[model samples]
Target: MTTIVLGAGAVGTATAWYLRKSGHDVVLIERQPEAAMETSWGNGGIIHASEVEPWSQPGMPTKIIKWLGKENAPLLLRYRAIPHIMRWGIEFARNCTPERFRENAKSNLHLALHSLKSLQEIGAEAGIDYDRATRGVLKIYRSRDSLDSAQRSTDYLAQHGLLYERADPDRCVELEPALKDTKSTLAGALYFARDEVGDSNKFAQGLAAACAARGVQCRFGETIEKIETRSGRVQAVVTSKGRIVADTVVVALGSFTAPMLAKNGIRVPIYPVKGVSITFKRAAWNAAPTMPLIDDSKLFGFVPIGDRIRISGSAEITGYDMTPAPARVAAIIANASFTFPELKRYFDISKSKVWAGLRPVSPTGTPIIGETRIRGLWINAGHGHLGWTLSCGSGRVIADLIDGRDPGIPVPPPQGVVVARAA
Candidate 1:
């Protein structure tokens, strides 16, 4: 079977790599000159299942209201420019119900845990190194109320096979002595020992190389023009370079998957949620922190990749534009400085590069995976904020669907009609 995969980000590359391993002729298409030159680049590289809570949780609605006009709000909605942002806001609020939160958390935990194991196995088999670290993830809180709330959510995740422990402020400083001087800012913390971190861009590039070595045709710098179908199955995918005939097509185009399908009359309710991150060159550490750090109060996180530190967070519902906002960058810097002051000397402030990527977000925050209404076409997008964390398992599940094998995990029901569109 020949499979055409759209987009060459982490998800797309992983899909191609696994599909090729499944004994299929895989051709990966990308709009960029190289794989992972888009959203998969400059990402917070923490692979965590325990930190898999949806953003639309109980305490978010009121907080969003308070943050509306604030310039540095962790999750900002630029309401002036995007009126449709309100619709997403309404839908997001609807999912904040206790029942929905619990359901989404459980569902995400399933994918995150499975994906972590799959990622480890794939990396070992391919002998791919992405500066990997298994020092776990520590989420620190700065307020008592916030710390208490996180405890409940962490407990919920831990109950569903995500092992986590509540760490006292002193314990947090002990885990990462870098936090010793900042002890006054800490209220408490939660540590997930199974969580790991690495460079997502490096991982994607490594996997792409592995796939090519396995006879997968990774077609970079090619744009997918359209998907031609008859009898409810994809026949061939038309691209700017040429027509790619395939027995199956997997729409792993990240945030663009929903819009591309909508053109073909598929009503996939996926939206682009903008996110930002900055990478700093590492100099030296008296002792490098062996863990990823998340500041709950500020809603931002920093992950170590060898010597460099990557800081990322913020979700703005501002459509397809890739414009970088200075205010958002400032907020990220503010949060990062508070978490790790030593980064100031190591990274040149003026020389630092800022980047923003649109996350393919679904209303429920859980990725829409499985067979779609269109035969021979499957979707593995909408992982949104958890794309890097969830890609490995999603690739395996998507390949299973293509191979007509039972996906070990329970698959979600098919979504409604999907309209396909040209890029």
Candidate 2:
């Protein structure tokens, strides 16, 4: 069967790779000249399966209310004229129940772990390098209250077969000495030794190259104007270049997918949650920490990618503004300096480049995957903050469904009628 995967980010590229491996002729389409040029570009880089919890869990409503319009809040919701954002936000609150949180976390963990295995397999098979490191990820806390909250989350994870070790302030320093500067303010931490980190853009581009090598046609720089259908199934995709026919099509267009699908009468309920990242040249390699670490108090994570250091965090709920906000950029730099003061000189604040990307977030915090109401149309999107971590597994699942084979993971029942492009 011939298939076209939309969006050339990690998810779309991985989907094309797996589809080709599954004996299908695949073509990938992306608007950017390069793959992973958007959300996959400058992520925190932590592939943490154990940390698969929804952002909308119980206490989130109060927090969201408090943080609305706050420049440095962990989650910011900025809005204007869109009803989808409000709709998604309301449903997000609905899913904050304890029951939904546990269920969603379990499902997310399964996908995350499976994706890590798939990622390693792809790395070995394609011999594609993304500056990956298995040095583990640590979530550091500065307040006792924050540490206690982490303990609860960790206990929940432990109940579901994920193990995380509790680390004292000294142990945290031992694990990541670069954090010694913040040791005095740290209350405690949690270490997930199985977790890893890497460059999302490098991974996507590498996989795209591997796909090309495997005879998968990648149509980069192609703007998809619309998706056309016949007899209630996808017939062809209309693009600026031309109309491309396909037996099946998977929409993985990230933030843009929602509106595009909505135009076709499909309400995906995926909203764009903007995030920022700052990548700097490692001026002090010896002093820098090898392990990826998250400062929970500051809501940011520092990921070491070869000679460069990526400090990324801050979820801004502004709709579709990809431009970097100076305030947010400054916050990331200031937060990094607080944690690793030894490398303060290495971090040239003036030279720090700011990048912002939108995360396609769904209400349930789990991606919408499976055959939609539209016969030949499928969806494998809305992985949100975990897109890079869950991409490979999602691709495998979508490929399985396309092949009429049972997805190894339990198929989530269609939550509701998945509307298609209106006539």
Candidate 3:
């Protein structure tokens, strides 16, 4: 069968790769000149399966309310986005209950672990050189209360085969010597020994090349204008270049998936949560830490990719706004420097690259994958902040469903999300 995979980011490229391997003629479409030029680019670079809890945990509403409009706050809600955010906000709030959060975390962790394994296999099979490291990830907390809260979640994940260890301040510095400078501020840390980190853009590009080598037609720089349907199934995709007929169409457009599918009478409740990242050249090989580190108190992370260090974090509840806020970018830099003080001297804004991309977040924080209500139409989107972490696994699952085979992973429709079906 011929299949058209929309949006050639990590998710779409992975989907195309798996589908071609499954004996299907695949075509990948993208608006950018190349794959992974958007959200899949400049992410935190950690495949964090151990940290799969949804952001809408208990007391989140109170935290968001307290952080609203604060300049250096971790989450910022723009006033202009209020009208567009109301419906999604209501659904998001409804999922904030403790019961719902745990259920969602369980599902997310299942996909995340599967994705890490898939990524490793792909890297080995394709010889993908993405500066990947299997040294695990360290998440440090500044307060005892925060560390205690994290331990609870860690314990829950431990029951499901996740390997982790709690580290005191001295042990935390011992794990990553770069943290030696910040020992005064650190309280404790949790290390996930199995987590991995790598450059996602390089992985996406490498996978896309592999897909092309396997006879998948890649149509980059073409904007998809519409998805045509007939008799309750996808017929063709109308693009700025031309229309392409397909027996199956998979939507992986990230935050843009909602609007494109809405035109086809499918309402996917994905909100555009904007995030920022800055990548700078490492001063010296030994100056940066080898392992990925997340600062839970500051809500940012530091990743060493080859000779470069990526400082990324900060969630802005803005609607489709990709403008790079200098303040927010500076805040990320400052927060990251607090954890790795040497970063202050090495980070040169003139030479560094800063980026902002919208994460297609579902209220429940679980990705929506598999056949939708429309026959021959499928979705593998709304992975949110875990898009890179879950990309390969989600793509494999969608390919399995497209081939009418068992996905081998649990995939249920997102709770309380109202998706319109075909008549």
Please report the candidate that would top TM-score against the real structure: 3
Q: Write the per-residue lDDT of candidate 2 for residues 363-417, one digit (tens) a residue.
A: 8888888766778788888888999999998898788877877666655334463
TM-score of every model versus the real structure = 0.94, 0.95, 0.96
So what's the TM-score on candidate 1? 0.94
Worst 10 residues of 3 by lDDT: 414-423
Which candidate number would show the highest lDDT if scored against the true structure?
Answer: 3
Off by over 4 Å in 2: 79-84, 417-423
Q: lDDT per residue, candidate 3, 1-423, as tens digits? A: 889999998999999989999999999999999999999998888888967888878888788889878979888988788889888888888889988888788888888888888888888998889988888899999999999988997788778767899999999988898888889998899999898888989999999999998899999999999989988888999999999999999999999999999998888888999999898877654668877999899989888887888889989998898977999998998888777877767668999899999989988888888666677888889998999999999888888877777777676454533243322
- Candidate 1 lDDT, 1-423, residue by residue in tens: 888888888888888988988999888889898888888997788998866777878878898777787778877766774576566667778888999988887888888888998999999999988989998999998888888987877777777788988899899998888888688889889888899998888899999999999998888888888988888878889989888888888898888887788767786767887898887765565554556898888778888888787788888867887877888888888777777776665666676668899888777778877666678887888887899999999898788877777767755323343332211
TM-score of 3: 0.96
User: Whole-model lDDT, candidate 1?
Assistant: 0.81
The collision pairs in model 3 are: none
